[model samples]
Target: MTLVIKPLRKAVLPVAGLGTRFLPATKAMPKEMLPVVDRPLIQYAIDEARAAGIEEFCLITGRGKDSLIDYFDVAFELETTLRERNKLDALEALGPTSIEAGALSAVRQQEPLGLGHAIWCARSFIGDDPFAILLPDDVVKSDVPCLKQLVDVYNQTGGNVLAVTEVPREHTNRYGILKTGEDDGRLVEVKGLVEKPKPEDAPSNLSIIGRYILTADVMPHLSKLERGAGGEVQLTDAMAKVIGHAPFHGLRYEGRRFDCGNKVGYLEAQIAFSIDRPDLGDAVRAFLKNYTG
Candidate 1:
């Protein structure tokens, strides 16, 4: 018998939205730059990818999103100034966050197309290997990184895998819902996927999250996919085409998911992360007590 180990080395981050909901803050900064605690939102996504053993990063960006690319670049002048000021700890913090040269690349989405288009822009970067996709808006806090959990499943299945969670029946319209064929603990065999289907029409309550391990074969479907629901080409629609052709499975992630795309979710993430931090837990607890009082 021969053993095979598939290579999962690259991750694509789609970050080209206008972020209109965030208003003035997003007017000057990319939404991904908004801080969850002390670290920016994009940092959390990148950290998760690094934890998953992904070596290369591909960011699909749009106009005025240069700051996101700069965030991961080495700041020689800033490092020098911090070094001179004896801020060695801060300097070291920046070191681990820096993506190695040639390890990170960016492709412009040009238009505010959609998730599918943003991912399609990275076709060259993805080449012929399987790649991971991380949506920074969905910040997952867990002992094991969310993508890493899915990667472990991919190692066993050797096919496309997506992160899935059960949402309320009423909320099925709010996400890409999966139609399941079979369940084996955490892995659910995907029969089909419906994008934001009505509660009555939804195939199953299993809602798809933002993390995915996609095969390169998906490129063709994304390129030719018709715009569905909201006049935009949805990634779900593209993935749906490859369902039975390839072994598509969904992994139910073990963690709390904060949908940082909305104001309420973002605020909740701040409170949740703050309560988890030992340095600020006491003060944060007291503040919450007084706030509730």
Candidate 2:
């Protein structure tokens, strides 16, 4: 029997966290709306998904997250001002911010449950097809976007696919670790998934990260609403149950990833992104040298 794989047209972005780590700044704005260079963290994730051919996007949001929802809306007044000023560059720059009517949806996660719960909140929008899940805090910079890399892997392996990067075994407690049945450098066949296991008990140092292309069947597991580590409905728990049913593989990305949710990580993303921008690179490098000296 030829395995059937449906086209992935929708993506889910779980942005409901309180972002307590970046408080004060985050207190007034959603962390997803936090600017990395010029574009907000969530926008980068959305752009990556759009580049992968996802036509519709669903954001799992929460209170104080109105800014994230509004980011995709058309700024008629701003556009008019730019038009009148003949700021062609600024006007064209706004083009990507225009999400087509009915193409984007934002659902509220009433409770601050867990990542799995936030994802489950968007179930109605997901329907039956497989969808991608991206965590905005984990900003991955790639020549070919990280999510796009995973989408290509999903096309080849119809089962659930997620991005993974190897970490030290001592640090396995920091991430969900994977057990393997087969391995080839970029793609590894997943035999098991353990959420933050102790170093001695962890099956492998290969750890699952933020990007995921999950099949619809995983919804039932999420529906169970079972609380796991951290006393929350963990996404890892749901994914663990999904292992034997079909092919599950961890894909190592060809890119650099930054954890933009914390202060140090956020600063790192700003510097990394700035150093790559033509307008800011030279000045930023000069400033860095003087500061270091």
Candidate 3:
């Protein structure tokens, strides 16, 4: 059997949700724009995609989300100002980070349906290619890059690959749980998926994270708009339909994941990322010591 790995060229980011969890903070800004350290949440997700060799980005946005698109746009005035101030390094950094003119495209998800609907909105951009789907809420810090690891496994197996992590059994109801099959060390065959099953009903402790490499075939399933657990079209429900027909597996990624969608998780991510910064580590450590002492 000849193995051919289709290079994942495009990635879809569903940023259309009205982030009600953060409330007042999210009132003016898209939740995806919330900063983790210095970079916005979406920027981290885009950086992860860039590290994984993904070239094109398809952002599914909603009303008041123009800022998300503009964030990645070229800032002519800002660049000129930086140049006049002799801040060439800062100018270079800012320009390099914005998505190149033609590299990014956005589609509007007019209604705030669900994750499945948001992804379906980007169907035209996805075309016939196998693409990546990344949820900005689950931010993974890793040396190898989480999506890149899944891409590697997708190449060998030629199937849908999802990033998986072992969550506490008691917290199984909070995540999309995966039922396991033959274990191949890092890649575990996915027998089925249970969306937020009760702890006792969960098939396994392995919960699906936000990173996914899906075939275009998934678009049709997403279009079904079948309401699942929360009366919203669930992506897991669509993913479940494709199990046996397509080779579905989970990649045990090596990394630390932060759920920045919640208040506590957001604060924890800020602390973790701040401590890892070379310039701020000492000061942050000193502050922490003083506070705890």
Q: What pairs collide in candidate 2?
A: none
Per-residue lDDT tens digits of candidate 1, residues 1-293?
34354789999999999899999889989999999988999999999999999999999999999999999988999999999999999998897669999999999998777888889999999988899999999999899999999999889887799999999999998999999999987889999999999999999999999999999888998888479878888999999988887789999999999999999999999999999999999899998998798
Q: What is the lDDT of residue 98 in candidate 1?
A: 92
The 0-to-1 C-alpha lDDT of every candidate, in the order given, reads 0.92, 0.91, 0.90
Is 1 or 3 the stronger prediction by lDDT?
1
Candidate 3, residue 195: lDDT: 93
Q: Give the root-mean-square deviation of each candidate in angstroms.
A: 1.4, 1.0, 1.3
In the range 52-122, model 2's lDDT, one tens digit per residue, is 98999999988888888787999999999999999999899888887999999999999988999998998
What is the alpha-carbon lDDT of model 3 when measured against the actual structure?
0.90
* Ranked candidates (TM-score, high to low): 2, 1, 3
Residue 58 of model 3 has an lDDT of 94
Q: Tell me the tens digit of each residue's lDDT in model 3 across 140-198.
A: 98888899898888888887999999999999998899999998778899999989999
Candidate 3 TM-score over all chains jointly:
0.96
Instruction: Mark the regions of model 1 whose C-alpha exceeds 4 Å error after superposition.
Output: 1-5
* Candidate 3 wrong stretches, greater than 4 Å: 1-4
Where does candidate 3 have its weakest 10-residue lDDT segment? 1-10
